[model samples]
Target: MLVTALTKLLNIRIPIIQGGMQWVGLPQLAAAVSNSGGLGILTALTQPDPNALRLAIRETRKLTPKPFGVNITLLPTINPPDYEGYARAALEEGVMIFETAGNNPAHLVKSFKDHGCIVIHKCTNIRHAKSAARLGVDVLSIDGFECAGHGGEEDIGGLVLLAKAAQELDIPYIASGGIATGRGLAAALALGAAGANIGTRFLCTVESPIHQSIKDKIVASKEQDTVHIFRTLRNTARVYRNTVSEQVIALESLPGGARFDELRDLVSGQRGRRVFETGDPDYGIWSAGVALGLINDCPTCEELLRRMEREAEEAIKGMAELVQG
Candidate 1:
């Protein structure tokens, strides 16, 4: 019942959002979220071509009539990923929600707006959220320091980040980062967020396409098991402390600084694809949030949502009872 502008814009039953993970957030995962009453977003960069994206979209429609979205990140241009084409592909696929991170997104807002897509820009700072609101995005995803990928230079936590966004922006915002359970959902609402957008929790769901070994790791991992990378580039991503991630961090910290391209082989998309596709954790990039400690099982999307709603509601009620006492 906690409907926001985003829920209305995307016609989803719940204000919750499932983030777009590179290898994990495909049509199957996205549709599962949508059908389970949350807004599921497809990671457009995962698709090799526009045709593949279109096919994926079609496949999702077959699974669920509920709404879903497409995520197109604005990268730092170290690689030659065609961002605009991804946006265009989403539009051609009749995407309802167009989410962009890592850029100003003014042009994306205009283009997607013209094509009748609801733009939800991910922001890590109040100024960024204000800018996105001014650009006419329908919703803002307020990412905090606890977020999995690139929490930005500000380092605002979800609480302060949402307060700032709520103070300045007219559009509704979803609190990202550090949110894992129903109690976290209640906390987000208390922090001035209309809803929550979760990544790590959804990643471990049964409907998610990632390998069981990966899900098991997330379920068993503790908060300390995660670490950050690329913080120097303001593109910091939180990933599990696996062998490959450890090596990457070690190489980055070396004194006589090596070239960025030297480690370029470390961050290869091909390497990531192979690892995520196969169950090979030794050589893969498993980006996740510290909330991995909180998740303990791989439930279906419906079961997860039900459990979250129950836990969140009960937590809020308990708090209310405490006040009454």
Candidate 2:
């Protein structure tokens, strides 16, 4: 049993955390992962309203009694939903864990703590990790440049990023981005991370709500199949190299290309959500990390976690023997 601070604090058997992908993170997927002994996360913003989120939380409970978390991403939107309302709804549903991302939740940190909820903030750099640590968050999920969603402007990968986090932060952190296989999990632990936060890998799981065709596309893809966009707008994101993403990247390279309005239609979340429903990878920009290349099959969450645990033990043992020999 590979126990860590994250697994102990979250009361889960494994330290693997399912990344809260918008539109992809539903009750079914979250519950399956939780039932498999890993920490699952339901995306709060995916619900239409706070009441809907409350219902979703209840739905997840019906599926699995294991502990799970809810992600409250505070990204900039034209008219953002009531974040406090969603948080309250989660609290009402007896949720004790929160995975906050996109923007600093300095305002909501205390409220979460008052309710005895453990907040795990996601950051892309050591600086942000330090800031979140100061806010009294229970843990940090340090994302690297290879992460699907907002990877920040920095280009550091997990190898260096996790090492830097180990050197600087006082709090325990999970390594995210480009993480899929058991070898990656072992590497993260060796780098001082308490767990691994996986996003794209879960998208191809049997319990995932995304269409089968989308899962197939991910399995067929290589690491180079992903491309970065929105850099000029200062909100970088890594996504699959589909037609829409390619177009957006090409537009960004033009002389008059530094504005969001120019590519708003091509990269809207609504369009990406449609792709998930329709099984069309070319429909819009969907978030995907470089780990898509590492996935070759659509295993059930239970199967995937079990395989990962076995592989992790073998890899660690191999390293130990190497040193002893």
Candidate 3:
């Protein structure tokens, strides 16, 4: 059994975390990951309201008795959802862990701690990781530029990013972006990460709510099959390379750069949801990480976790044999 600060703290059998993906972090997937001994996260904002989130949390509980988390992403939305209400609902429903992303979590970190919940804040760079650590967050999920969704504008990949975090941060961290296999888990531990946070790879799993065609596309994709959009607006997001994403890039490159309003209809969340629901790859833009290159099959969560455990052990043992002493 692979154990680390994350495993011990979260009380999970393995040091793997399923990323709280929007339109995808439903109870079925979350419970499956947790049942497989990794921490599964439900996206709080995916629910329509605080009450819906409460129901989702309860539903997840029905599926697995293991510990799971709620992801409350704080993005700059003109009409933001009731963030506080969502937090209260999760707390009321007995969620003991949280994965926060997209903005400074100074406002909620203290409250979560007060409720005896562990806060795992996601950051894109060492600077932000340090800032989150200063806020007394229990753990950091340091995301690299290769990550899906908003990877920050800094564009740092996991190799240098994880090493830099290890060198600078005193708090435990989980490596995010481009991680798919047991070798990746072993490498994260080698770089001083308490665990690894996987997104794209988990999306291709059998229990994932996304359509099979999308999962199949992920399995067939290469490392370069993703493109970065919204860079011109200073809010870059990594997503699967598709006709729609390409169109956004082309528009963003024009003259003074395209405004968000111009790309709104094309990148609408509803449209992205359709792609997942309808099994269409180019229906809309969908988040995908560079790890898509490494994923080869759609295995059940249990099957995937077991395989990862075997692979991680073999990789770790093989590395130990290289020691000169």
Please report the candidate that would top lDDT against the real structure. Answer: 3
Question: Cα deviation in Å at residue 88, candidate 1?
Answer: 2.5
- Candidate 1 lDDT (Cα, whole model)? 0.81
Residue 324 miss distance in model 3 (angstroms): 2.3
Worst 10 residues of 2 by lDDT: 316-325
Q: lDDT for each of the candidates?
A: 0.81, 0.93, 0.94
Q: Assess every candidate by TM-score.
A: 0.94, 0.99, 0.99
TM-score for candidate 3, residues paired by index: 0.99
Candidate 2, residue 185: lDDT: 92
The local lDDT score (0 to 100) that residue 161 gets in candidate 2 is 93
The Cα error of candidate 3 at residue 65, in Å, is 0.6
Count of backbone clashes, every candidate in sequence: 0, 0, 0
The order by descending lDDT is: 3, 2, 1
Off by over 4 Å in 1: 322-325
lDDT per residue, candidate 3, 106-143, as tens digits?
98898899998899999999998999999999999999
